[model samples]
Target: SIWCLKSKNVPTSGCTFYTRHFLCFSVDSPSRQDDEHKLIARYTTRLPLTLILHIINFDANKQKRELIAQLESKNREILAEIKRLRAEHDAVCQPSPEKGSTNPTLLAELRLLRQRKDELEQRMSSLQESRRELMVQLEGLMKLLKDEEQRQAVSSYPFLGNTETVGFSPY
Candidate 1:
């Protein structure tokens, strides 16, 4: 069984774990170093422990499925917007009955529509750039996810030291 300080017979009532830059494991140990059993490393990012558990269960297939779903949804929206813009462009391009009339208002409307088209084109370009960056990020995450899956598989047996990758490596 486990041991604690409240009494030689008393075991840890319970424990809680959290994640930041590194995982933190707090137990009810009444050791001399820490009478309260509280041990927190240097502060860093505050990623919840629940998210870590989710990452623990991820597989390569799941990643692919989620990426595909996102792309499908994004493509549908883009297609719809492109269709709408094309209709607007066509309307502006159409020849009016007053072809010889020098109407300032018509010219202004045409200019405004052209400006809208330029804005749409710029947005599309940025979206494409964002997609490329996301793909790169996804690739890096996949490698880390695969490694985590392997570690979970290996820990089927008892671990000698801390199973948590919290401290520095020996090598």
Candidate 2:
């Protein structure tokens, strides 16, 4: 929904609904029109601040969730890749006893495969480290998301999460 704007290239239609609502009023009775205008003005002044804040917070929460999901998916893919790499490395590094006995070139090829296997192991270690770091970051972000959600829930009571130091406590 955020990707597609309803008003494309229409240079900032400032509050289209309010504009339409404003246009519908009758000007035949000047006093009543003035009262209606005042009411609409009050609504215009008060609505956007709270509404926009809520929308912003909600959007931010959704984006964080999306990022976490993407990271989790990538982590899973990396795990699968690591598994494949391990299998390939094992196959290459552990040649059968009978296979390399007669052929000198096979011995040479086995040496090269072992080197490639070492490189693959190194790469796998790095990916594993990266996965660990990503998991930590994901956990921290999830905690933050939960805290933010709780804060929003009890926003009416601003002091809910705070500790009261009443009647002089010794630290």
Candidate 3:
């Protein structure tokens, strides 16, 4: 189902060996087909069958080298990206005067504002409590004024309390 292209012979030890130099191709069926019946050609070669094994090993080694190279490239890219991100983080988190404004001044201003806000809130709460107490006192004073007016009116009309003047005109 698989086939190699170029062939070169190399002498090793006491025998000649063939080295594979081209890419392999896969075939579902043979390149040539007979008209009468399916005549599939069996692959034949002058070189030893061990040449196929050597070719397969070479291809595997080449693929392994390529994968290692790609992995190394990706690792370098990731390391560079990490370095860039760390720099950006430092730039944002660590403020300097050269970057624009003074950090200590800004922090001090923020603290002062927060303290002022707290003081104002406390003062407002005290004022609200004082207002409530004043309102209660005002209500008590109003009730006292109404009772005194009623007493004065009853004293000024003393003859209205006499029940014996039913048929007498004492005007």
Candidate 4:
């Protein structure tokens, strides 16, 4: 009879049932072993399934908050810069007290300020688009996690009876 790891029928003492079909290999050198350890540590999920899911949810939330805060900060900085540029441009455009005409040097500086304002505006547009895309992606991921959690809840308790009223459903 085929035995599962959880089955009581399997012997407990040094029973190869858990490892029967698996092959064990060793690294050829200490460096290789260290590399293997690093790889495993990097890729392995050490927490239980539920905890892992919770951590993922928490991480998603944290990332969204951080993203918003970062974007807002950038937006504020860009706006302030644009405002400063506009003020400088206006000051430069004002008639010189003595010359009563736009100085060539002042005109050149105004051009540079306008160019910087345009660049900042373009950067703002790009940041807004990027934020929109990221929010959409995060929303999609949260939806998937919600669906998975619902599925898990249903599977974990068969007696729950899949129904919307009970807030649990099985697919």
Candidate 5:
């Protein structure tokens, strides 16, 4: 059993006090102690620190998937915009009987369209680089987390023998 206490004012006499009791268990009983120890051992063996690392890895994988989807959507949008711009430029460049010549305004608009397309291409390249960097970082973090979990598992179970003495250096 476990008990919890909550109070607004701090105790000044260096004496501890308990309030708002939630649970009470008799730890004086040897049977209870044995049961608690058995429970701890069972739980630790079945779900060790490695489980935490697995959960983190799963989350990272999910994020990567989401990022890929977003990147694809963005690329589609950029492509559509470029197509629309090209159509508009073509419409402006159509020959007019009144002028029967290339208009300066149409030429400037075409130049602007080309500039926008180039900018979009540069942005796409940057996004690709960012995605690659994120993946590399995620891989490194997972590896470090795995190594830490293995170290924790070995430390938790003493009966498995001293990992360091056995030449099993986690580092």
Candidate 6:
């Protein structure tokens, strides 16, 4: 039989109740004769135990997905920026002997383009570093998620302890 502790103002009479964690309850009947009867009590706390864990898990999953998307977008943007920078650098590095025919304005424009190219290269390098850091964080979060899932799965099953051990290997 299942009983909810919050149904009454106080615990029901003749019931020995002990709270375990948040949701689980350990009940023992004072009378030995009641041993045959198994009573399961679920105490509703401010928050259900598993629900909170699941909510946290949901938030972590959402954060992980968002981070992954951000990382991918950043990676693409950084790649494009790097490619653009390289093209600009190549153009700047090319020897232009048109200095004789070029006007003063054209010379200033070329100088500004060269400076802009340098700035873009620096920006690209910084973005690449940020991407690397984000990737490391993503990997760590993924590992944490895997570990949490494994822990949940292990908790769902009863611990068989040493009884489940099979043949031993001598190594």
lDDT of each: 0.62, 0.68, 0.67, 0.69, 0.70, 0.65
State the TM-score for model 3.
0.35
RMSD of every prediction = 40.8, 34.4, 15.6, 37.3, 38.6, 38.1
- Kindly list the per-residue Cα lDDT of model 3 for residues 1-171, writing each as its tens digit: 554343334223323335544334354545423311211122234556798789989999999999999999999999999999999999877867675455667778779999999999999999999999999999999999988886676568887445346653323
Q: Candidate 2, which segments miss by more than 4 Å at Cα?
A: 1-44, 48-51, 101-103, 108-171
> How accurate locally is residue 118 in candidate 3, as Cα lDDT from 0 to 100?
100
Runs with alpha carbons beyond 4 Å of true place in candidate 3: 1-102, 160-171
What is the total number of backbone clashes in candidate 6?
A: 0
Model 6 / residue 86 / CA error / Å: 27
Give the per-residue lDDT of model 2 (tens digit) for 11-106: 123334422233333435556557655665665565568786898899999999999999999999999999999999997678677756867898
Q: List the residue pairs that clash in candidate 4.
A: none
- The C-alpha stretches of model 5 lying farther than 4 A from their native spots are 1-101, 162-171
lDDT of 5 by residue, 41-130 (tens): 655555657886888899999999999999999999999999999998886576565544457786687789999999999999999999
What's the C-alpha lDDT at position 4 in model 2?
14
TM-score of each: 0.33, 0.35, 0.35, 0.38, 0.38, 0.36
lDDT of 6 by residue, 1-171 (tens): 333342323445444445432222334535423422322232234457798699999999999999999999999999999999999898767746784346687778879999999999999999999999999999999999998976666566546222337543221
Better of 2 and 4 by lDDT: 4
User: lDDT of candidate 1?
Assistant: 0.62
lDDT-wise, the better of 4 and 6 is 4
| Tens digits of lDDT, candidate 4, 1-171 | 221121222224333555344222343444656655554554444436787788899999999999999999999999999999999898756666764444678668779999999999999999999999999999999999998998788778878754777775455
